[model samples]
Target: MSKTVVAVFSSRGRAEQAVSSLREAGFNKEISIAAKGEDHKGGRGNTDYFGATMAADAGDGLSDGVAAGGLLGGLAGLAVGAGALVVPGIGPLIAAGPIAGMLSGAATGGIAGGLVDWGIPEAEGRQYEEDVKQGRILVSVQASDNKADEAASILKSQGADRVKTH
Candidate 1:
């Protein structure tokens, strides 16, 4: 059996460490990380919101054209798995990791819906969405049942808030 683990962090720095820790623990294949703005209309997050920059060898950040409106400058010269995106109702978002695909997959549903689809309870999904909107970072990993405890421990050690299994 496998377990989907989710945790919320207060900042990008901690979020990044949790991701790296999970990877080092051998849960690298299906990790997901995401963040939302905390101040003003849109949160002002720098590129390293996830703690570490993507290695150049990881590929490249995705892009197309720029959108007008929020804090996101646009997806230009970004590291792999990171991009500037706009989430409906949340405005401009700078995200990395697997969340880049979740946000970019559709225009309307975006992260909150994706969170629900990922097996997070609807209420908790909305709470996570709101936390991100308020400048929080979230990391999730799919781990086998045997590794679930270890994964959650890694996240907790890195100051992950509300760490839970789905």
Candidate 2:
């Protein structure tokens, strides 16, 4: 699988610094930086909001699964899996019942779908989003497992105080 590893920095400049270091470390062509406000819509469309909302819904769905294990679980599951709710040829199946099924199915499908959407594995994407919400910057790289350590090493060398690999 093509994997993306992200290194979180404290500031946009620090992220840039890490990018520069990554370039020097031989990942120049593959590295990219997501600077704040660089791709903003002046408060209209917010990627962060979307990402965070998705994470929250997923979390809620998981919590519901642990709580009720039936109807609520299905509802929570749907909310969590809302990001992957797509209809091919037909329109969206917006009914609560089916939506709940989609959410319930998320326990399995959401993982792969989320990974595909975030460009990282499902577990990694959740963790990354959590870290970002806590005010940390994320640096992601896509490569083989062997290269993950080296990429992490470079980020840490450039002042990434805390690093998590998934």
Candidate 3:
């Protein structure tokens, strides 16, 4: 199965730089960057924005979709919760097959319809909301399991401060 990985950088410039390095490292098509931070007044603005953005982006891994079932989910949840107090939201729920199936059923009704209409569960939805509230940026990548490790390694080599693999 294909998995997603996220790399968090300290600044937009660093993030962009990492992207460039990642590309050179052979992960050109698999990397992305998001600038996170709060808008504020004067010099405080820059600091607040960078801090908020980092928290938000870093906290994203614990949300529902990113962390569903298995070890990855648990680790993501713990990491997010501990790092930023963000809860796992729809991301995790949708990733969890049972919850996703239930949400699909609630949305459409029939098993076939439910199967076709994928959705995350309520609990997970709530978790996503919490993650956002914490003010974090999110970077997502979809790649095969084997590629995930390499992608993460490339991001790290390129100076990604925090890299999460799922």
User: What Cα-based lDDT does every candidate model obtain?
Assistant: 0.62, 0.41, 0.37
Residue 163 in model 3: shift from native, Å? 1.3
* lDDT comparison, 2 vs 3, better candidate: 2
lDDT of 1 at 110: 60
**Candidate no. 3 TM-score:** 0.39
Model 2 poorest 10 in a row by lDDT: 89-98
Candidate 3's error at 62, in angstroms? 24
In model 3, which range of ten residues has the least summed lDDT? Answer: 75-84
* TM-scores for the candidates: 0.71, 0.44, 0.39
- Per-residue CA lDDT of model 3 for 104-160, tens digit only, reads 334333222322222324454333334433443333344688788877776677665
Query: lDDT score of model 1?
Result: 0.62
- Model 3, position 25: C-alpha lDDT score: 55
| Cα error of candidate 2 at position 142, Å | 1.4
**Sort by TM-score, best first: what order?**
1, 2, 3
Could you give candidate 1's per-residue lDDT for residues 1-166 as a string of tens digits? 7788889888556776777777777776567766652222222322333232322222222343122222232221122365555567875555655666776775377667877766777788888888877877777777788888898899899998779999
lDDT of 2: 0.41
Residue 165 accuracy (lDDT) in model 2: 52
